[model samples]
Target chain A: MTISRVAIIGLGLIGGSIGLAVREMLPGVATTGWDADAAVRRRAAERGLAGTICETAGDAVREAELVILCVPVGAMNAAAEAIAADLVPGTIVSDVGSSKRRVGEALAKTLPGAVVIPAHPVAGTENSGPDAGFPELFRHRWCIVTPDHTAPPAAVEALTQFWEGLGATVEIMDPAHHDLVLAVTSHIPHLIAYTIVGTASDLEDVTRGEVIKYSAGGFRDFTRIAASNPTMWRDVFLSNRDAVLEVLGRFTEDLSLLQRAIRDGDGETLFDLFERTRAIRRSIIEEGQDDARPDFGRTDH
Target chain B: MTISRVAIIGLGLIGGSIGLAVREMLPGVATTGWDADAAVRRRAAERGLAGTICETAGDAVREAELVILCVPVGAMNAAAEAIAADLVPGTIVSDVGSSKRRVGEALAKTLPGAVVIPAHPVAGTENSGPDAGFPELFRHRWCIVTPDHTAPPAAVEALTQFWEGLGATVEIMDPAHHDLVLAVTSHIPHLIAYTIVGTASDLEDVTRGEVIKYSAGGFRDFTRIAASNPTMWRDVFLSNRDAVLEVLGRFTEDLSLLQRAIRDGDGETLFDLFERTRAIRRSIIEEGQDDARPDFGRTDH
Candidate 1:
């Protein structure tokens, strides 16, 4: 039941982070890492992202019991196609992709011989690359494992333990449900942030400068969200295109309604909406999703 | 000229914060604070929010050479109406409310005896009351002064020194210009955050919980903006109605373009917009407008 040998198939934030988390939590575990970019692999090796830097995808996953495919979702199918021939029989294949359904389907289709356990560690920063990866990045974060009926019980249990051992609270859900939930939580929000900040970036000269200088007002929050990895987000929107558009359509309809309320000076409606949103922050605090202290529970600045 | 004696009316977040800042930065300055709510006044007094808590608004202004109206824009006129009778001749009166045009008009009409220099400190938090007051809150922030044509030179200089002493950078602009800039930078962003978070909260029950739980994706940023002072924001939207609506119109148009792009699976368009917005965050970071850290540069959090 012990996961001794782990191979991470990318040295970017998530893959390198998984290597670091496993090393810290499961000392003595042999870990191998690989990436198409030699510099990232070098950094991962120098920073101890893995116990060993393998020469190729095949070399990385050759003897490992678990192989985590932590590449962009748009590239996941291609990566799966490339590694399908190299992945050992009974090797548990998982990923750290934002979208579960597409990655799972790609894995099932491209690497049917391997035991695929498509899991998403629902955590990240607007940061990327090997240097940005932290051992505790996944700690206490949710990692939902979407294992279809075809996924073996032993494979699911082993992959779940691997994620749980890294301090993630593992949950099981269908890939389609996962896509819908994330469409609301992650994809749509990122899309909207990108749009609003993009809009402001296009403002007239004077206002554009003020927009950046006075970003503390609120526009900066969207910029931070918009600053998220472009390729990853681009892949997310493309991969979860259907669910994202569905939720996004709902959001636009609601936005228009509120816009009408504001345009009409419907103070009661605006105030009511405002008050209800406050409770969401409180609930987030109570759920341990955020710090209870003011401003993400930071007691002191 | 030394701003030795100061009166802060309607002791909420801004009032109490100004009182706290003055006391901290200028130890010998005399700060007289007043609020309509006896409970609020008591809390300010208990927290030593000022040198003394005045029994009435008039009492707070009677002996002060400088007076700051730190109340909602809606209440600014009424608050000025209450204290105008006791304001000394040539006394410098200003405000710490948003929407400079409305507040400036209220000042000119109600406090003609005082030298009116309406200001808006573009800084605040969602928390209110005396306990939330912090001296450093005004430091490193912009304080916009909308000075009237007849505003005495000495009064403007004195108010400028008062803000500078608290580590603020003051910018002088016309009242309408201030309103328009803020509507684009602050008001519309706050309104957008409130609406989107509100829209997410009104989602079906199961989804609503997930929204709050996984809010770190981007929705949490909106919640913080949405959690801002309701009455103050309500006043902001109402007072600066035209500007907010105008900026909001631009935003909706941009959003609609994005909606079409997403619907059409235009990955290139989404990526381009997302990439362009990244430069805005970079500019903010380069200008030191925000720390290149999480939670939109709230270093405390």
Candidate 2:
């Protein structure tokens, strides 16, 4: 059950980073990778992203003890189906999807005989594609593994070890809870970023040019998050619909309260909320989740 | 009118930065500064934020040809009134307030004999206070000068020159328009950040510890912005109430569209909005408003 022969089925940022990290961290493990895009496969070869860049999904997973689908959440089921017939009967199947419940279901439904244990490595940059990854991308980051209770314990343990080998600290959680937590932590933040960026772009009185120039005042941070892969993010929201919608509802309600406070010129209400939020940021820095450097140590100026 | 003798009426990040920038860029011009906080004044003196750290606002403005109030928007009037008796009658009075219209009105009403011009340097870091000042904070940044139409041309021109000397590109804008533009670009973004951070913190199902640990996914960026000065932001939201409420209304409307899309599983709508925002980010980087570095070039892994 040790994940030594691994197959990576996406070759984008997450897949490519895993490939590079495995090469650097787990030298004994052999990696075979395939991408739906031929260009990504060629780039993976050029970057030496895997020990072998297989020409087909079946070819990639045929001998792999572990098959990790690294495609967008929407594409997970198709990827699982492609590898199903070729996967070794008891091969440990997993994915690097943002949302766990849907992705776990997709993998299980497609590869019924295989051990479908889904995980999400909560680490990435705004950039994507094969060229946007580096070996240290997952270092000191969280990798939440959401395995179905019916799945074999040995397979889950091996998958956890596999992620830990790549420099991530691993957390085990139920798929539903993972989705709910991430909805607040990742999904809604992105949704808000996309919305505000869109709102700023469509303003009648303010020129997009002006918005761009003054972005550093605060708008640019949202732009960075909003610039993340649209396809992946769109799939995330769609696949994790219930959790996302629930969180979005709460966010909207909270926003309305602030909106009312602003309209009423209630400085105390605004000040109280603003003050409460600061302690969490302090805890994030203390927990080593973010850099304490000012402006995130951006040297863009 | 030439502004050879300048006084800064607050010694926080903006005020301290101005003092340091003036010293670097206009060596011939002397600056005197005073802060309501005694400890901040001590730090300002140690950092040489001004040529002289005066004991009182009156002492700071007594011999100055120009006085810039760098306090929060809520305190602009009081800062103006504090220096009123000591300010030379023809002194060119300005401020670095986020909400220009209210600040402009406050300055005009309080120091009627002085040339009242309000300016907002649309530049900052999340870190504030005296120790956070750096001379290069304003370099390559936009400084919007909002002067009353009836104000003298010579005073406007002199104030423009003063900011330009500190390495900022100056744009003249109407105070009301400046408030609206900043509501979209700065105030609303901050409000959204604060709201999201607060929303995440209050989730009963998700632990605050988990939120802090997994923040690198996207929430950390919001936390950095939400960590900005609560008093400053409280004042901004209060002073720019009408504009902020208007922009917040628009933002909520836009967010609702995306929220509906998520609930309906409409990937296309989400993708379209997400894709549109990337271009604004590119423009911001191209215009030198934000650094083009990845993860804001953070090294604290």
Candidate 3:
């Protein structure tokens, strides 16, 4: 890869996974990582999340050729500012934030003259933190790289090669489109899962104990998604407000149609929609984006 | 177990699973199964899903002490009618339907004087049909038995023992309460998943191919659930319309709050709700209702 040194800010799941992945995949590339939380830095250091778990963000980025801000979308600007003074000229700055348009704009504004090529690796477990990361987390997963007008071709190419080295297939998309696509694929799903989980827990008739006990029906799958990091998701919604709201509106409209069908006992409408949705699942499995085994091949089953 | 011959009408996932579980757990108990679809019956026979894959519903339940209807809730009356004449007096009739109230009422109406105890095993994969069953499907899963006033205590005890024999924990609940609980735990979740999957596929700006490609970002999980049997889910919504609609209304209200929070950048509300949902996930894992591993411990991951 063209990039020789990498600096990763935020030692949580995404940042830690990237550090470990780089260690395993691109041994020649040196990595330095930092997290604002001291305890996390200690864990990252113990886990060897990077070649050097630096004490400060500036220290981590001082000699790096590529600096990837792996903090929450809401924290992207602050994280960028932390390393802006330390970043050398010609360094390509990027982020692993879910929302690209805002993150791209934030990084560009913070690091005035630096190359900012934002990217989001569309993969994660519900679990977060230093311990939750593994080197293979990105294997066979798509990493969408959203580059704006300021990013040079060479920088984007180098970043793509860096991700490919970690076993991710890179897709180049516009910042606006990335925000919209992920608003549908990731943001709305998380929002709905979180909302349903909250609703189920707050129900007066159905006890939370009962909901938890009988969750194997379908609720448990949602619980898994809803268990995702709060700060990260909270930032995602705030950062990608427009796209999330637009998609959420569409989802609400679609949901209303299904709700009316149920109310009217329109079995045909329900069955047709259910059947059509199944085709998408089949396509996802065929594309190797999900487990084909029943119930995600959960070991307990 | 007190019962000897066990009849399973409709050799699909649930029916076939009970048959296989019987063969694996209760070696002495005889099982006779019949499916409306001739193809499913053939597959059940090949898989040895039951001790005897009977040619007709009447033949299956002719000598059975317990007959469990495993057809869709919408088909319960027809399936019950098919075997009603052959059911001996004092035989206990039950069903593996998502909605209990309607199923309990239908079973009672179709087979007058027969002991009808409806039960719903809150367990399944996104798969259906004869090939999608296994002996261990019910292990560590909850089987909620809804017994009405007409159901004898002895019959309920025997049914509970049968499910226990298959390695399921039995919870006896009132039929109406059972519908409400399942509406929140099962029906509403399925409705939302189906709706979201349909929404994602139907999005004009976001191509279906792109959604499938980047689905690992939470959308794929919903797809797994949305891929559930169309007929079964349709029947569930139609039969449990009241409870499903009720829970769905609550879910919509909750979703609206989150949508508004996102629009208004109310991160605290989002963060607080997200944090609370994580506890439910932990409780589910502690209860052994779900896999504790990240990403449901999918083999590919």
Candidate 4:
């Protein structure tokens, strides 16, 4: 039931990192990879991202005991479809998508006979593509698996062990709950960052040059989040529409209250909210979820 | 005249850092400091935040050639008033407030007889209070000085030199322009962060523990900003009401556009805006305003 031969369907940051991690951490596991873009395939080959670089998705998954789709959420169905016919009768299918419910449903529909267990490793930098990945990207990060309740227990156990072997703490979560949680923690934060960065750039009173110069005051943090792969984010917003919109609604409502407070000169309300949020940051650092340094310990300056 | 005797009122992060900086960078220039809280004055004395930790604000400013007020924006007037009677006739008065127009006006009204200038060092960590003082905090940072055109050239030159000695690049800016620029750069970003963190914490569907656990996905950055001194931020929003409100209006408009795009599945618009903000981040890095490292090079974990 152990996963020994793996196929990575998209050699971007997540796929490339998984290939590298398997090579480094699970040296006995045989890894093969494929990318939709020929240029990325060439780059992945140059980096030796996998033991074998297959020309097509079907060829990559033919011998793989576990096939992981690492493409964007919008392309999940196509990637699953490409490998659906090639995957052997016992092959287990999985993916590294942000939104779990949609990706799980897509994989289940496209490859009805395969064991489909969707996973999302809550780890990444603001970089993508083959060159942007490293073996250590998933170390000490969370990997959430949303397997169908009816899926084979051995397949679920094997997938959890696979992620654990690559240095992640595995958690089993309901697909719908996973989407809702990620919507708050990841999706809404990114939307707010993208929105604010756009807002700063479009200001008529403040020059873009000045905004860049004084960004250390706080705006630079938002810029980093906003700089993430546009294609990936656009697909994320489109795929996880409901959860994102629901969270965004809450964010907008809270923002309106603060706006009213500011306009009314309600210092107590502002102070109370600002003070309350500090505890969350402290808890994050305490739980080893974030770096506990001043200014994220940005000493590269 | 060169500033040999400097007095810093309200010995918090900025004031204490300035005292420590003067001691490290300009040993010959003696520094006297005062804080309203007795515990803080004791801590400053223990840390040797200044050459002389004065018992009163008047005692700190008496016979000083240069005096800098470092307090919350709402408390600027009171901090200035504390030293008005004791200031020597030729002393140059300045402050380290976030909003220039309001601070400059406050200092001018409180100490009309003395030369009043307002300056804002565009640098700080989330940490505050006496223990947060560090001599190198201002290294390679920007310090905006908004001085009255009617002020003597010698005094202005001395103030600029003082900031430069502390390892800051001094920029002479108009008070109104400084307010608008900071509104976009610092104030609005903080406001949005505060609002979002508040929203996330109050979500009834998601457990607070889940939010803290997955914060590294992007929520952690906002939490750090939202953790800033609540009293200081509340005062900043209240004092810079007009500029913050104007910037908030623009931010809301931009966010609305993004909301519509998400609703309509306008991927191209999201991609374009996301791509545009990346350039700003690159410019900030190229200009040495922020760290070029991935994820702010946060290695404290």
Worst 10-residue lDDT window, candidate 2 chain B: B292-301
Candidate order by decreasing TM-score:
3, 2, 4, 1
Q: Candidate 1 residues B102-161, lDDT tens each?
A: 778778888777788999887777777768878877787788888988887778988988
Better by TM-score, candidate 4 or 1: 4
Candidate number with greatest DockQ: 3
lDDT of 3 by residue, A1-301 (tens): 2999999999899999999999999999999999999999999999999999999899999999999999988888889888988888778999899999988887888898789999999999999999988999999999999998767999999999999999999999999999999999999999999999999999998899999999999999999989999999999999999999999999999999988998998999999998899899899888899989999989775
**Local distance difference test, each candidate:** 0.80, 0.91, 0.92, 0.89
Please tell me what DockQ candidate 3 reaches. 0.89
**Residue pairs with backbone overlap in model 4:** none
Clash count list over all predictions: 1, 1, 0, 0
Model 1 Cα lDDT, one tens digit per residue, A144-193? 88999988787788888888889888889899988888887778778878
Residue-pair clash count for candidate 4: 0
Task: Please give the TM-score that candidate 4 achieves against the real structure.
Answer: 0.98
- Model 4 over residues A204-246: C-alpha lDDT tens digits? 8789989987887888889888888888888899888889989
Query: What's each prediction's TM-score?
Result: 0.96, 0.99, 0.99, 0.98
Model 1 regions lying over 4 Å from their true place: A296-301, B294-301
Candidate 2 — which residues are off by over 4 angstroms? Answer: none
Report iRMS (Å) of candidate 2: 0.8
In order, the candidates keep a fraction of the true contacts of: 0.53, 0.83, 0.91, 0.78
Q: Please write out the lDDT profile of model 2 over residues A124-144, one tens digit for every residue.
A: 989999998888999999999
